[model samples]
Target chain A: MADRNEILGAAQGAFNADPAASMAAVAEAAGISRATLHRHFDSREALLVELGTRSLDQWAGRLDEVDAEALAASGDAPAIRAALETLVLGYVDDADGFGFALTDHVILANADLEERTQVLADREAVLFAAAQRVGVLRPDLPPRWFGHAIYGLLVSGREAVRIGDVARRDVGRLVLSSLLTGIAQPQNQDSTP
Target chain B: MADRNEILGAAQGAFNADPAASMAAVAEAAGISRATLHRHFDSREALLVELGTRSLDQWAGRLDEVDAEALAASGDAPAIRAALETLVLGYVDDADGFGFALTDHVILANADLEERTQVLADREAVLFAAAQRVGVLRPDLPPRWFGHAIYGLLVSGREAVRIGDVARRDVGRLVLSSLLTGIAQPQNQDSTP
Candidate 1:
C-alpha cells in the first residue's frame, strides 16, 4: 500500500512537470524499476486513471483556499475576479499534470471524475449567485450558464498559453476582462464620471 | 494524384467524424486498402499535417466570407461578433478533426505547420482592428491578445460539448458574450441616473 502511494505521488509529480513525459521516465523518476511500474500500473491508461484521481483530489483541496465569505462581503466584481485569478494561476502553475488529467478525464468520460469536477461548477455557481445578488452579472443569464462561460474561458486561456498566443501570466486578466464588460464599450454610461 | 486526394479527403472526413478513428478505418472508408493508406500518409503524423493544412484552408475560406466593409459601416461590435460566431461554429462542427490536429500539432511542434498557422493570426488581426475602430474592444488589450482569447474560447467550447456540460449549439453565444462583456457586471454611472 505504501509503495502504491509512493508510486502514485511520483507519477503525479512527473505529470505535473511534463504531460508528455514517457512512462519509463516516470518510473525512473519515481525510483521504481520499470518492471515494478508496470506491475503497479499495468498500462498507461491505468496509470493515467490513478493519476487523475490524485489530481482531482488536489484540485478540490485548492478550492478551499478561495474565501467565499470574503468574496460575498466585498465588492462582487473584484471578488469574483480575484477568485478566477486565483483559480487560473493555480492551474497554470500545475498545468502539466492538471492539463493531462483534464485531457484524460475528457477522453475517458468517467462518471466519478465528472462528479468530482462538479466541485468547480458548484464553486462557480456560488460566485455567480454572489455576483447576481450584487446586480453585476446579468440576471437573465442563468447561474449554470455563467458557470459554463467561466469554465469555457479558463479552458480557452490555458490553450492560449499552450499555443504561445498569450503569455501564461496575462491569461487570467484577459479572460476576466472579456467576461465582465464584453467587447462593446458602454454606450451611454460613464461609470467613472 | 486523384487517388491520393480521395484518400486524404476521406481521412480528413473520418478524423472530423471521430478523432479516435484509426487510419485503417479511414482507408476502409475511402474504399482503399490499408497498404495504400500507409503509402500515402507514411504515418498518422503525416496524415495529421495534411489535415492541418486542409483545416487552415477551410478556416481561411470562412474568414473570407466576413464582410469587412459592411462590418466597418455597422459598428465594429456587431460585425466582429457575427464573424466570430461564424468562425467558431465552423470549428465546432469539425471538432473531432480539429481537436486531433491541435493535439498532434502541440505534441509534434512542427515549425512548418506553425508558420502556416500564422495566416490565422493575420486574419484575426483584421477582425480585431475592426473592433477597435468601433470602440467596443478595450484599446489597452492588444489585438493579438483578443485573437488568442477568441481562439481559446472556441477550443474550450468544443471540449465543453464533448464533455456534455454545455450544449454544442450554445458555444458561439457563450464565447461571444464572454468576449464582449467580462464576468463582472457594469457599475452604476456617476454622472447620470
Candidate 2:
C-alpha cells in the first residue's frame, strides 16, 4: 500500500480542486501509478471513505483549537467575532474534504457522525450561551442557534467558492459579516455600527 | 412504474423522518410492494436522481414568490422580514427533499443546476440590491451575498431539522433573526427592537 499521507495529500488536492476528480489523477498527483492507487484504495468510493474518516478526525481536532472559556471571558461582540473567524478560516482551508464528507451519504450516514457533530455543537453552545448571558447575543435567540448560523455560512460560502461564484479568500469576510451582524447596513439609530 | 406523486410523497416522508430509510420502507410508506418500488426505482441512487431534479425544479419556482419592488416601496424591515418568512416556511416544508437535492452530486453535477441556482440567485440579488437602495440591506455587503446567506441558512437549517438537532418549527425565528440583524443582542444603544 502507498503512504497514507502521500495519498491523502494528493487526493485532497484533487478533491479541493474538483471533487469529481478521478482516482487515477489522484494517483498521478501522489507520484504513484494507477495500480498502486488501486492497491491502496480499491475504488473511488473507498478513497472517499478514507477521506471522510480522516477529514472528520482532523475537523474534530480543529474544534479544540478554539478556547471557549477565553472567548466567554472576553467581551461578547469582539470575542464572538474572533471565535467565528477562527472557525470560518479552519473550515475554509478544509472546504474540499469537508464538502465531500459533510454532504455525501457515505459520510453523513456514519453511525458516529451525528454524535461527533453533537459533540462539536455542544462545545460551541457554551460560547453562545456565555455570549448571550453577557447580553452580547440577542435575548430572543437560542444559544445553539449561533453555532448553526456560523456553520451555515461556512458551508454556503464553501459551496459558493466551489461553484466559482466567489473567490476563496473573499468568503471569509462574507461568512463572518453575515454571521456576526448581517447584510443590513445599520441605520443611524443602529448602535452596534 | 408507480405514480410519481405517490412515490415522491412517500419518499420525502421517509427521508425527512429518516434520511437513511431503506427503499423497502419507502415502498411500504407508499403502500406499494417492494417489487413495485424496485420497478419504479431500480435503486436508491435512481430515486435520489429523480429527487434531485424535482427538488431544483420546485425550488426554482419558489424564488418568484418574493416581490422585491412591492417590498422596497413599502416599509423595509418588517416587510423584508415577512417576505423572508414566506420563503423560509416554503423551504422548511420541503426541507427534506431539498436536503437531498441541494447537497448531492447528482443535483450539483447537473449543468443546468448551476445555471438554475444562478438564475434564482440573480432574482434574489435584485431584492437585496433594492433593499439596500432602500436602506434596509447592508451597504458593505455585496448584494449577492444576501442571497448566498439566506440560501445557506435554508439548507443548513434543513439539514439540522433532518438530524433532529432542533425542532423544525424553531428554525424560522433562528434563521430570520440571524439573517436580518444577527445573533447578537443590542446592549445600550441599538433600537431596532
- The prediction achieving the highest lDDT against the true structure is 2
In model 1 chain A, where is the ten-residue run with the lowest total lDDT? A184-193
Residue pairs in steric clash, candidate 2? Answer: A137-B185, A138-B185, A183-B138, A184-B138, A185-B138
Q: Give candidate 2's TM-score.
A: 0.82
TM-scores across all candidates?
Answer: 0.72, 0.82
DockQ of each: 0.38, 0.45
Native contact fraction per model = 0.50, 0.57
Interface DockQ of candidate 1: 0.38
**Candidate 2: segments with Cα more than 4 A from true spot:** A17-35, A42-46, A69-81, A187-193, B15-49, B67-81, B187-193
- Model 1 CAPRI rating: acceptable
Judging by DockQ against the true structure, name the best candidate: 2
